[model samples]
Target: MLLRTLSCLCLLSGVCLAAQAQEEKKAAIKEVTVFLKGAELRSESKVKLPEGESEIVFTNVAGNINEKSLNVGADNGAVVQSATFRNNYLKDNGPTPRAKQIEDSIIYLSDKRNLLQNEITAIDEQINVIRNNRKVSTEEKGISTEELKKLLSLVRTDMKNLLDEKTKTNDSIMKLNTRINLLANQLREENNRDDDPAGQITVKFYCKKATTSNIVIKYVVPTAGWIPSYDLRVPHINAPVQLAYKAHVYQNSGVDWNKVKLTLSAGNPSEGAQAPKLNPWHLGFYRHTPVSYSQPVYNQQTSDYTNTAQAGAIIGNVLDNNGEPIINSVVQAIQGGIVKNGTVSDFDGNYILKPLSPGRYDLKTSYVGYKENITTGVIVNSDKHTAVNIRLQPTDHRLEEVVVRDYKVPLIDKYSTGTGRTITSDEIDAMPTRNTRSVASTAPGVYDGLNIGGARGDGTMYIVDGIQVYGARGINPSQGSNAYDNTMGNYVATENRGVNTTFDIELPYTIPGDGKQINVAVKSAELLASYRYYAVPKMDKDAFLQAQITGWEELDLLPAQTNIFYEGTYVGQGYIDVRNVKDTMNLSLGRDKKIVVTRDRDFTMRSVKTIGSNMKESFVYKINVRNTRSEDIELVLTDQIPVSYYKSINVDDVEYQEAEYNKDSGELLWTLNVEPYKTSTRTFGFTVKYPKRSNINL
Candidate 1:
């Protein structure tokens, strides 16, 4: 009886042990709230925990994960007594099932190719055997001509069929080989050519009871980020520009964020929230020794707007007067008395504000150079997603009223992903340089646009009226002084000097290792400009039409390359270096072939004389201009004569017949009023007296 009881107890103990042991469950990625530097990953599992101290593990999570950033929790009143995290290194962190299937397909194709190759070899041998006919004996040659012809026909027929089969086999083999190679390559790049898979995360949780509970796992992983970008378009000088704000989001978190809620925060979690402490400024007795100064440093451990709807989420887009999406526009939902920070609009001008308490709130949206759009009341319901779209009007352009700007862009714009300076048309007109790059460097945080490594970031573009007039070029900056200070958040006025103008932007962008341009909306504007024609016949025969812009200084323009178009045709491109210009700035549109010009030297006016120890040589030049256009044309013909630089050489006999000559620069100007097919002529003469044997560049 005692033995039988022992056996029953053993059987009961074994069954209890079997029921207590549980298989590990995996947590599927539920949602991800991405920030600039990192992301918040949330995963859930329908876990079945055994009663009384059972272990539940989640395997195969992102490998770039910050283990310390991981958080494990449970629902259904299931308590997590203790939890531990580790990489499942013991597990074969191989390719996905799909990748393995691709490899298997490749192997199968390789075998198929081998079989086809063997068939091809057989066909080749058969063809060779048929082709190498046994040499006919002398006796056999004596057969009848009809019989020989019949034999030759039969051999040709057999050889042709064999060759066809061989060709088909070869083609089949080639196709199989190609497929095999392609699948193999696909398998090789399964993990984006990464050496090893990001190991699975093993989360061991200790729960008390066998209950169906919800598990939430969160962690931060690298290679997950987004950049702020935008597009701006304006119709006319008086019209408001349409700005499309956007975010280029990318992540290699090893999980697809398909249909998951996402959030973008201006707050940085990597940076500690500790306020900086100010130490006493002790005035120490200084010595006459060498010393250095440096800024204070607190060596701290370091550290996109996707429109995903969360509970109590507010989603919308912002636009301008023309109904165009305004990129990088700011959206704020102010509740209570707290001034809450809002999400900047994405490239499509889309914005999402979520995780809010149900209540009525004030909403505001603002764009650069545009009036703010404010909403007095917006009701947000709990567990519900609300929609709110905003529209802003552009500020009127009052020429006389100088709106002293405090920044090149909006205060929050520079914090977006990459470094780029936007110069408005007004700014370009004020400080005219040779190219967009030159003018861009004047922005507070900008530095030598040309020196920016990699593909050129979208710098300030040169626009005439509302058209993009110029292409890419190395436009060096003119004389200017800039004091730059940049930090984490977009600085409103950190170490500021000069015009405080900035592009109002939302997110920070990054240039790739290849230095590719981050497509962010830059500074742009429109100006009002007059047209005329000027020509230097002695230098270039073509007459160049120019635009004389007044009130340019008020425009605050920059030196940049100019794209010239005339009467609707693209003439050409030229540089505008305003550093050496006087009053009216002339922007040469392009050469006018309709106006012909020529400078001819007439030897008839030449005369030589020996004045004391020096010899005098005289010469004459005639500038001829003609109007090739059907109508009358206006032209300013110009020429120059040699000017004596040394006292030893004298130039006195300077005669101008139909030209105005400048004594300082030896320049002769002729304003020609030529009718259709009419000609205008100007004659100028000058004499140079120099040392008899001294050479001159005449």
Candidate 2:
């Protein structure tokens, strides 16, 4: 009897242990928070936990997860003991249904293309056979001349028909090839998920009693991110500019986000939140040659970039004054004296500044023993190449000179797109290392000084001369506060989380695992803007309409690509560079064709005279602004005089009429209120006295 009782207890313990074993439960993704460089996915499931120790395994999770970011929780008196994540290599996590369909379609198109190619081959063979018959007829023995003529005619007709059919078949094949290429491209985009095994998160929990408990799990994935973009629309010069903030969200996490609630955050989890430590800087002896002080000559050639709206590039060759290539020249695209993008010239002096948003930037090129040349107002268009040639002069060695050129706003802009979060000058100035790459790396999505995850190769079609081509924010948040305000827009809930700004989308979205961009509207607002017509007659005779908005900081904006719309017509693409914003933000609304501007040198006032050992050159520039529109307009005319960089060169007799003059930069700004059908004329003159042997470029 005692032996039987012990056997019964052993059986009961075995049953209890079996009941506490791990229970696999599939978790449904409930919500996702997409950051600038990563995303956090939250999933939940309900499972019954037996008394005492129990385990729950959540399967089919994101494979590209950051293991250290896993968090698990349970309800109904269940205490989480431990949790671990491991990749399920045995399970086959194949492509989604949509992706599979795309693959199948690609296969079908490829087969069709092969069949068309075979048809072309058969057509060629038929043409060859007809030619062979023609040759045989010509060599036939004792055939009548009329019979031979008829046979030749028949052969010629047959050959012509076969050739026509071949041409048609070739056309069909080309079309088929085009279709196949598109499908292949689509398949590639849809197949961008990581090849790692599916993830399984197992959580061990302790329960006081047997109960049904709800379990939730959350983790972060590095393969998902979003980029901000905008659309600035202006109804007219007097109306406000409508700002539409949007986000281009993308993910390749090996899991489809179907009907998942999304919250886009301006924070980047890839860059840790810990404050960076500063290292000591040790000074070393200067053994390298210094940069030259010679005068630089800049020439820019531009082409219209009206293709797909994507990031563009600036490509050119860096050469010396003697037309020799300057290898290892450092070329930078700068705005507000901050280097936004930079590249080093190759051995052949060829350099390509890529992935630049559509906007105007100053191109600065410098090399050892060569003077630095800065080309102001170089425009970059979207998906187009803009060429800018740099010619640096050799050092004169005798003269120690410093030249400061006045800043000029570009009147005409080319098309382009934008990316990269803006790092304010203040933030960079406070950093221990002020390196351009180091400072830009702190911005979201910038890794190792490169903007990653923003490249798109969708195999878009473009015809050029009948040829086809394919081309590619800091938020302040409270401490763990979840308070949000949804009064901004309908579909999105704007939340001012501490240290970050998040937009919680109200409606659920079906975002695929593909890494294609799906634009999501974040916020929209109509702010009061000041309008003025600006003209730099020295560079461009056309007048550009600019709008200035105050308190743009409240918009929580980052640097992004902007589409400009003026008077309900699409003007072009522009970039909102909020890195250097101050009291007001200015946006160019494109040029106004109705307003004409002209700058002419007054030869009558131009004179050169010798005074002792120095020569004095007098010059006068006249600017004319004609307003043809029916309404009165305000115009800002800008011009500049050369600033003396050396003590021997003196600028005297400066005369600017009703304009703001900056002595440091030698820039003259004139604001005029011109009425309709009226022409306004303004003149600014200056005299430069320099050494007789020295030449001044005016």
Candidate 3:
């Protein structure tokens, strides 16, 4: 009995030791919640666990993950002991299918190109041999004249054939070279990095008994993000506008998301959740000091609107030392130690850093296997697009570690449409902001758009110190901001979380690891809109058809570029800035040639007089709207009289017919209905009285 008891104890000890052994398993990404700046990925695996503590290693995960935001869970009453994340440099996350295809084509073309060059070289060598033997050797035995002539003729024929072959081979090589360059361009567009390693998650779990447990893993990655855009289509003037909401998703997060459930969140999890604190305000006398700045060495052209605080943009290309385009290279605009906006270079290596206030900024460009290039003192002038191309040098060694960086995109992309309101010096002076960036932010074109890094409220909720806090939450449906509607939730489900909105795509999507924009439909709605023709002849002589939509808040719209289509025709592009929308959402359709508008100064009513120390100038302007279309149109004509801020100048005797005039702004508006092939005219006159010592242009 003692011998049997000792044998049983030894067997039990052996079983326990086997159960505590470490096991490696691969996790499949099941879902992904992509934020404006980051993405949360959820993966799952099933593994058999033994009764004691077992170390489970999950392989083939996103290498660009934020380790602090990683979490692991298990079923079957398994208790997780510890979880850690590490870069798996050995794991092969092979090139994407498109990239592989391009690589194969390039290789095949390159081989052909080499073969053609070899053939050309042989042909040249044969030609040289024929030329060298042109002269007969005198030491050699004498030969017949007829034989010599035949030999010379044969050598000439052979040389001609060789030259012809060389020409053909050279042509083939040229064609192959062209094809190889095209394939290279395509590969760059794919933005595939073959050496991008996978990540691993090591989790230690304790189980009471041996059983198969379902394991779930979640983590946040900063390399993936999405941008919002819209398609606004109006069939005709009387039809309701069809709004198609879409998301432009992009990722470079090592792991390819194949048929994964996707959710797009407007809220950013990278932004700080801590509320900002205000410092104590103090009043002090103004100190005059001279400010100096170093000019950009590459570009020395000064802007004309710099003093007006107009928004500007920087457009450039990211290239390698060999002048090859570097796709998806991160470009950041840094101002005063803070990164203002960031963007990645396109497939063509072009990047646009937009909506920057007229000021000096530093540009930093980074890529995976290249040395970072920092260009300081890049001047962004008002109402201009500055070109600043950057060249990144390739690294000599492989990168063993991945460094994660935050990238922020501009709120307003003025360069896209080549249209934006310029803030004047007076407007900047009236603004409460003290800095140039703040003044630009307050400008009319700025939008509340997507960000790649930084934290925002309402992203994820957490419990801190037994108190509920708004923090990182992922994978759990209770915390997920998935959008849904009773009837319209088939393709996309939307949820309004007050601070931000989320669109959960119902269908499975296969977004590759390539850093390219994948368009996803979010929501579609046909909203009723009223149409009217508007024109400000003083500024522009063209009449624009505008669509006004009421109750636009229910659309859950974000600030994005909107493609306008009217009357079954594609119109110009416009911007939908939900942050600036109020009682009505007015969209401008393209100009209408059918409605002719003209503004002319009425010389008969214009007069100038000097009374004592004061000079009075009277100006009258007439605006005519001619509706040449078959249908009658309603036109709103607007003209403004100069508003004086000084007490010495006063605008008086403002006269108009059937028009509304604002007293403070001195703006005149006339709403008129004109029949087809008929014309309607309105005239407004105002008198400006000022001291004779001052000169004013009217």
Compared with the true structure, all predictions reach lDDT values of 0.53, 0.66, 0.67
Highest TM-score scorer: 3
Considering summed lDDT, which 10 consecutive residues are worst modelled in model 3?
450-459
**lDDT tens digits, residues 1-698, model 3?**
99999999999999868745657788999999998777889999989988998888898687757776788989997888999887777655566675677677778778878888888888888888887777643234877788777887898799888888888888888877876776676566554254555678889889889989899999888767886756566555666777777676877676789999998999887564789999999999999985433332221011112332356789999877766666556787877754555676764679987657788999988753466699999999876789999987754432111111112332112222112322221121122110011211111122122111100011223432222222222223321111111233467888877787888888898776645456566777778889777777876777777777776678888765554445433343344557766766777665677888998998998799999899999988888899888778888788887898989898888888788988787778888899999999888888999999887766
Residues 407-431 of candidate 2 have per-residue lDDT tens digits of 2332112222111222221121111
> Candidate 1: lDDT of 91?
54
What is the total number of backbone clashes in candidate 3? 10
Could you tell me how far off, in angstroms, the CA of residue 261 lies in candidate 1 after the best superposition? 3.8
Candidate 2: Cα lDDT at 616: 92
Q: Which segments of model 2 are wrong by more than 4 Å?
A: 1-23, 103-194, 276-488
Q: TM-scores of all models?
A: 0.41, 0.61, 0.65
TM-score-based ranking: 3, 2, 1
Clashing pairs in 3: 37-452, 270-454, 270-455, 271-454, 271-455, 272-455, 483-493, 483-494, 483-495, 484-494
Which portions of model 3 show Cα errors greater than 4 Å?
1-22, 88-103, 110-166, 181-198, 272-490, 497-499
